[model samples]
Target: MLTELIEIIKDTFLPTIVVTGDTALKTDLALDSFEIINLIGILEDKYKIEINVIDIVSLITLEDICNYIANKKMP
Candidate 1:
């Protein structure tokens, strides 16, 4: 899932420079507030999970996003 998320990020945002784990989303990926929303929409649609704005604010890293989706699984 992490790998898939990384791929999605890469495909969604074509970074001019190399992106690594340490790279920040707002700086390296240039993902601003609006892009974040767009990303959430894509993720929600792709994963079939509902994402809240608070969830988006709480996410800082790729792992965070993956973990959020993982935890939202309907049991």
Candidate 2:
């Protein structure tokens, strides 16, 4: 799932950079405010989960996003 998310991010957001779990969504990718919002939307849609606006701030890395999705997927 993490791998798939990386592809989606690369294809949709950054094609020039290689994204890994440790990649910082802010510093590494340098995603601005709008891009971050768009990314959150894409992630929610792709993973079928709802992310609160407040939680968005906590998701600073690829690993954070992966963990959020993983936890949301738990039954």
Candidate 3:
């Protein structure tokens, strides 16, 4: 999940992981509301899971996303 999220960040944002870690999604990535929405859509389609908008709002870093994805996968 971390690797996939890293790839998404690299493809979506020009910033490398060096400057931003997990939190880069909200900070260094500079992703706006629309971008976040698009990202959620991409993730949902690729992961085959339904993501709530509230989750997106609460997410602030790469670790957050990774943890969220992991939690969703757990039984």
Candidate 4:
């Protein structure tokens, strides 16, 4: 799941630098508000789960997003 998320991010942002789970989303990925919305939409479609804006705003790092999706996948 993490690898998939990384691939999505890479494809979306086309970052020239390497990205890791600990990377800060805003500072490192430089994702703007529109890109963040796009990410959430992609994640929802990929994971088949609903993610709210508040949940997205709370995410601080790539790991946070991965963990959020993992937890949502749990019954």
Best by lDDT: 2
| Poorest 10 consecutive residues by lDDT, candidate 1 | 15-24
- What is the C-alpha lDDT profile of model 1 across 1-75, one tens digit per residue? 777887778788863556554556676577899988888899999999999887677787777788889999847
Give the whole-model CA lDDT for all candidates, comma-separated. Answer: 0.79, 0.90, 0.75, 0.87
Candidate 2, number of clashes: 0
Error of 1 at 19 (Å): 4.3
Models sorted by lDDT, best on top: 2, 4, 1, 3
Question: lDDT by residue for model 3 over 8-58, one digit each (tens)?
Answer: 877876545553344656567778888888888888888888888778877
Give a tens-digit lDDT track for model 4, residues 1-75. Answer: 778888888888864668889977788888888988988999999999998888888888889999999899999
Of the pair 1 and 3, which is ahead by lDDT? Answer: 1
Give candidate 2 regions above 4 Å deviation.
none
Shift of residue 33 alpha carbon in model 2, Å? 1.2
Task: Choose the strongest candidate by TM-score.
Answer: 2
A best-first ranking of the candidates according to their TM-score comes to 2, 4, 1, 3
| Clashing pairs in model 1, backbone N/Cα/C closer than 3 A | none
Which prediction has more favorable lDDT, 1 or 2?
2
In model 4, which runs have C-alpha deviations exceeding 4 angstroms? Answer: none
Q: What C-alpha lDDT does candidate 4 achieve relative to the native structure?
A: 0.87
Residue-level error in angstroms, candidate 1, position 55: 1.7
TM-score of 1: 0.82
